[model samples]
Target: MKLKTTYLGKVYSFSNLKELFAKANEEKSGDRLAGIAAETVQERIAAKEVLSTLTLEDIRNNPIIPPEEDEVSRMIENSINERIYSSIKNWSIAELREYILSDNTKSEDLKRISRGLTSEMIAAVAKIMSNIDLVYAANKIEVITTCNITIGQKGTLSSRLQPNHPTDDVEGILMSIKEGLSYGVGDAVIGINPVDDSVENVKRLLHATHDFIREWKIPTQNCVLAHVTTQMKAIRQGAPADLIFQSIAGTEKANRSFGITAELLFEANELVRKEGTGTGPHRLYFETGQGSELSAEAHYNVDQMTLEARNYGFARCYDPFIVNTVVGFIGPEYLYNNKQIIRAGLEDHFMGKMHLLPMGVDICYTNHAKADQNDIEDLSVLLTAAGVNFVIAAPMGDDCMLNYQTLSYHDVATLRQTLQKQTAPEFNRWLLEMDIITEDGILTNKAGDLTIFNR
Candidate 1:
């Protein structure tokens, strides 16, 4: 395949797919930090130009990290429907991008074609797409998964009630969950990012949140964002949990850095199905970000965006109830600023939808990053318009434990009302029953009062 192109009468060439993929990415500090980003704007465009002409087969044949070397690549390769792949193997990335955006292309059509795609192919198309293109195309695909309730239906927006505490204080965490529920959030899950990952601490949070959900009769799931092994141990010791949470990466080595393997995930899946809480199937929750692989020194010279796509490829194998990219939480060293964060948020949502994962975005940033609440709010709106499955919500948009800012309980309520969207159907019914929201899904006068749950 040709890896050279000319733009503005300047010749630009990339040595291989790995280099070309890195250069084709939108400006990201992670790639630049790795010294793999294009040296000039024209060179980046030239890489995109060359990338656009590559065939699906070309990308498949030139695996960024060969299947023989990476289990993630092998899993992604083995997951493709060879029959479907053979039919569209000759299509160029540009044609693939246009087809996704074509008025004639419906959601079902995209779903059918998605079975043929490899993660690399998906990333290639995303690199050539504009921000609006990412939103419009992603809006066409709806991926629904059910753990305690169904999510990702059109006209529906969900929020994960992230009730994190600075010291794993059960009371503090419960206060946040009560506040979030009072605002009609938590349809996705009442997840906690524990300051401690010990099995005992994880079990404590799980049991506390489980008891709260049971007492309120809330139609939502509960999870503690602990390591897979920790959660597995907690569950084995008889802790109640609605879902198991883990952070995943695009490459095997990065996953190892997190102390997870595909086999471990499979074991956790089995344990959750047999010994844990929640309804039939769809019980895994995965969190990912753009720079995780590079942070672990496992990117294998591939661009962060492509590696992000591969995360979906790995995530799909478990049929996770939700998969969200913590877009800006990786810091300025990777995403840089709000513009890049917004672009990555859109890219990840689009790519996950294309991979048919129940995709969401944690529209968040660290304190030191060159962003503020306004930028996060703007991306939240953009993601909402793109039909995202869910977003993480903290009290007042501040996660005291993680020390990052994300969507607040109030922000979620406002987004739903302003966008004319509803929560998951089951949770929506619960909200009305509790007088938290009106029949039309607007927050009722009684909403935002934690005292209501006191009864």
Candidate 2:
């Protein structure tokens, strides 16, 4: 194989870009010179004859040749292609929201005629909506598509829906395996608490998610956060920053995991940007499940940490879904006194401290513990009056569904439908009228051109 390398700021076979430019200059000017320079640059580079030392200063001072528009287009297209492919290889289904919806025309142009579109349309819409650049393209009417939304079983998180968490059984695991094998699941993860020393169990779950993604060709979120955060805290708490960095750098997997998580989160932020076509139904939420509730101090720390998370973006720290029975009080005496309990649980960190993620009464409906139906209804009404987004309703014993009256699935579906009809930059003002989301929902369009308006 011939040795290949770049020299000075350019690549060279015989040693210089100057000679190549000289030969090209003998015959062309204007677009033709541009065309030759554009075409010749690659050959020169490939032949190892590029002048690597060339810098912006070189261009500003010597101005050998202005880069051709075609060259620029080619480079931009290459970069985009690389990004799209890399994203597909590394990201999970949850992560795909921004990428799939990026090319709007791929999604929106079909919406007008799409009676019952296929999974491809759904995936395309999701990808277009999530990718900011693609969405920007759509706003320019160069692309047309809305964000995609499909709800399949989401691994352990979904299993939390079934009674006894039965999804953990061999049969359930096998079913998950089969679905993953068949494409019924997107990214099916099987996470067990590391505290449980269930390494084998964790591996099985990871493989299940991985296999499902491979078989179904759906993207997957790395469920490593729950495990890694806990482990990282233990390992890196007191280690010097340099040491931590070195340790992380020493392994590609270690370094990449953090990067992957950060990228996914950043993508999520971009997808839910304030200027998007439609607003998300749930503005804020608190994730307090296992490690979330430890000591009361631990709970407080989690609350503080979540507030910190919110500072990074739009999440807030708040109580888990609230329920009346959990308070263990009754009647007006119980009701009057328990208000303080619920209030303390929800408002402990809200005054200039951290944003709280309460269940907006419209969103959650729950009956945790109440002897009478009226008692439950009273609490539900109180939650609604308080303007909480998620509420705990125990309509089904033992299996309480996270209910939402204000932000229904139907409402989300409608908002999505509206957004599908509208492209980026185009205002879909009618979304405000839908009342499923907020009036400000479509306000983002004011900033651009392709935006659709109610009129």
Native-referenced Cα lDDT, model 2: 0.25
For model 1, how does the per-residue alpha-carbon lDDT over 92-127 read when each residue is reduced to its tens digit? Answer: 999999999999999999999999999999999999
lDDT minimum window of 10 residues, candidate 2: 239-248
Error of 2 at 310 (Å): 10
Indicate which candidate wins on lDDT. 1
TM-score of 2: 0.25
After superposition, candidate 2 runs with Cα above 4 Å error:
1-170, 173-195, 213-286, 289-455
> lDDT at 209 for candidate 2?
40
Model-by-model lDDT, in order?
0.93, 0.25
TM-score per candidate, chains pooled: 0.99, 0.25
